[model samples]
Target: MGPRVARCAILASAALFLYSCTFFEASVVPPGFAIVYGVSDYYPASPPISGDSYDLTYPDDDAIDMAALLVEQGFDVILRTNEDATMTQLELDFAEIGSRIEANGGSDTRFVFYFAGHGYGDGMDSVYGSSFPDAWDSYFDSESGASEPTGSGAFTEQLLLHDAMPINSISVQSVDDVLAVLDESLSDDELSDLLGTLPSSMQMVVIDACHSGGFRGSGTAADTIPESYEGWDEGVSVLDTLDAITLYLDYGSGLLDVGASDVGERQAIVISASGEQEFLYEGPVYGNGIFTHYLLQTPAEADRNFDGLVTANEAYAYARDQIVRVENEFFFGEGKFVPRVSGGAVDFVLFEAR
Candidate 1:
């Protein structure tokens, strides 16, 4: 939508399953380039809390599969899974893509960025003995709130990279800094000129993780979960939950600012796995984040009209419905997750049906 500068922290709990960002409307751009990443393991080699393993079962698989899918769609892809999906490597890959795009006559480049792994929104404090990276000390304060211990509730949501620790992960600001690096490399005039010729440049980002919706910013009252729900166990506070939880569909507050645009169209679409207050699961049934499992099925299972082509909206509706249905059947309507998509009228085509 627009640009957002502040954010609030989300209250999250360690879940038994996995935890785990959108596009153009109607018009399908030819396959261009993609950056795919997933992490099934992390640093420190242990869970910050008991029973909370840094190791996940399906994220790496998700990344590899998603990359393969993009490849089938005719996209040039840069894939990084597990240990290779580090922040350092991501930056390098992203920069390389930018350089390559600039060298290739500055044409419009469509980018598909897929990340499946962990997302942390519970602020940057380690309640346990785990030590987080010091770089995050400025943005998250566990005692105060958001940026300051006594400050207002304003903290950036993060997409936990492979090396991410309890209080250390990649934030909106971190992404923005990366974009800024690219922006600084080009003169403002040159960037403006490039935008004039490349109006179709856009990015589609899909994320599967817990509290992933925070990337979309705060939501309305409709996004709040009632305290009466039974899923709030495992040592989470009802009051804190009520205060921190929100659907967060404000695309302005998302990673759009960090897209390939930097100062161009800002046409970035985000698809997130769950609401800010909800937790999503990964089970042996799918061996993928529930949303991703269904998402990968879109070409076949989500083609509701049997059109032989899947649009962004179709994939979202398909995955969202399946997630609700599966979770309802398992939790008996007690625990369910709502998937979210945010961008500007982004109903573009994802792929041809199988």
Candidate 2:
């Protein structure tokens, strides 16, 4: 079902003692466009394990909740979940939404692309895939003088399809023919919606509620999980899984450095649910992700400036702290999930600019 637009009114207290409530017209900000993706299950064989090693229950909830929030923000939101969250589907949705925004809006169009799902990471480049990968190829980059991965093809970053398979080279090339006009590369537009919204403008971002193995040149996600499943499938090695993470952490457009150079300005803020080397934990504590839970229901304490406008930086800091507190209470400090914020404009208006 599509996200129905409804008026969202938030009561802001002028003072604890006064108990007076000031309502915000949700429309304080112009309605924007949003396409959200969430996956509670992974394709291929999900390692038969229990507890935190198996399928999650709240990722889909997280997506729906975020969509509701976006709708409240006056966005025409499109929600995609489970098998529908394939890589190809993601690309197509962006292209279609981009076209719509291009035709009806201008550089001022606010667009948000959000995803909450499973993410695999090598120590360096993670290609957050919705589907689990069964293969990985590693090679050296002569120009960057670093080692990179080639999973199923030469492209560095990729998303998994509904059957839990990555889009093959032929499919990617074919789709690029249609998507090239936006940024001349699927990776560029895939990283962020280019054809529909301008990155230089406010209210546009690629916020992912996924995990990055480590923050740039550190460890991989393997360090958090049990090593037994490292070789669950004969063809898929743990290293291959590491190479499959597609969340773009690079300063450029995409993970492979094939990204659009102009995006280096990092016009908007992209929020990650956890840090590079942390696990994105989903517990029944709230039947949803802790970071996401806080992100949606941000504690009143987040209005640090007391200015009524919750800037991007303020929201991120507040959520990250809450994630840490909740995880510590749940895992007894054995596991940690810290959210991260990338791009710039920490002062960008996230909520009402009042």
Candidate 3:
């Protein structure tokens, strides 16, 4: 069956199950938690434009859709968009988030944050922006046709982290610039200490960007970076920066060793659209990026083993296989495009209430 049809079936089954349960006797599941942010346009000091303007649309849409799905599964979600908000507003929103977390009594809360927008990297850092201005310097001209910013730095993840919300999962549809900011945020030991301060829960981060190789333009979706960005290079990988941040925090404890399984105890999963040697592509149908499209369309039932849950590892495995199958069937039949997921095992439950 098509994805839409499969989704409908799942919804129907869920509704029936909930309806059949005794009203008062029914077990109450704690609500899932979420905070969503989407930035399409930028302000006066924005980054350079790339590809096409439409690239901004999909990530925001993905965030909304994800929020809707979470709501369907009984989550209490707060969504923010760039259209009617500003960066200062986002900061305030995050502060409120911290308050809410404290009020909710963090123990049972499972906070998730999602961002979809442009990302860039500096020589030693990566950044995520709401619009081209934040990601590229080329778009900073007075008459430049780029989106206006909401005053929030292109990267808002650190701000959120500073709010001390105790987030469990963070899914970012970052471009190269945003990744640079993430790297910078982690440059200090304070950020690492903040990460360490959180409860021992599963954490998941999903990034979609082009890093290397000739696979850059194979897809069909629009990009927000300018054609002039064809030669732009931030000089660092978001993953590597994250690793560095963690290493700095490890402080000779060897806790941040690469490929170490125990690291799963704290931060758990990272799903990247392409490998370190490949660049993620945007296709027409996929809208945002090929990897993200596959992730959203994946059927919950695909977790055939019925582990009562589908971890990030399982989701990535499924998405990788499917992305390859689709790519081969359509675009790059002669070439292979494989998405990747790093870190260790993470709990990513799908059929559970909330």
Best candidate (score: lDDT): 1
Model 1 global lDDT (CA atoms, 0 to 1): 0.57
Residues 219-326 of candidate 1: C-alpha lDDT, one tens digit per residue? 222223331133333454565454433213323454322212112223445577875445667888877777888888887777777767777768878887876666
Compute the lDDT of residue 58 as modeled in candidate 2.
Answer: 80
lDDT of 2: 0.49
lDDT of 3 at 213: 13
Segments in model 3 whose C-alpha atoms lie over 4 Å from true places? 1-30, 44-55, 83-91, 124-200, 209-265, 286-288, 328-337, 350-354
Using lDDT, rank the candidates from best to worst.
Answer: 1, 2, 3
Report lDDT (Cα) of residue 120, candidate 1. 52
lDDT of 2 by residue, 216-261 (tens): 1211111223221121225656654654353234333355543232
Q: lDDT winner between 1 and 2, please give it.
A: 1
Clash total of candidate 3: 42
- RMSD per candidate (Å) reads 15.1, 14.8, 15.9
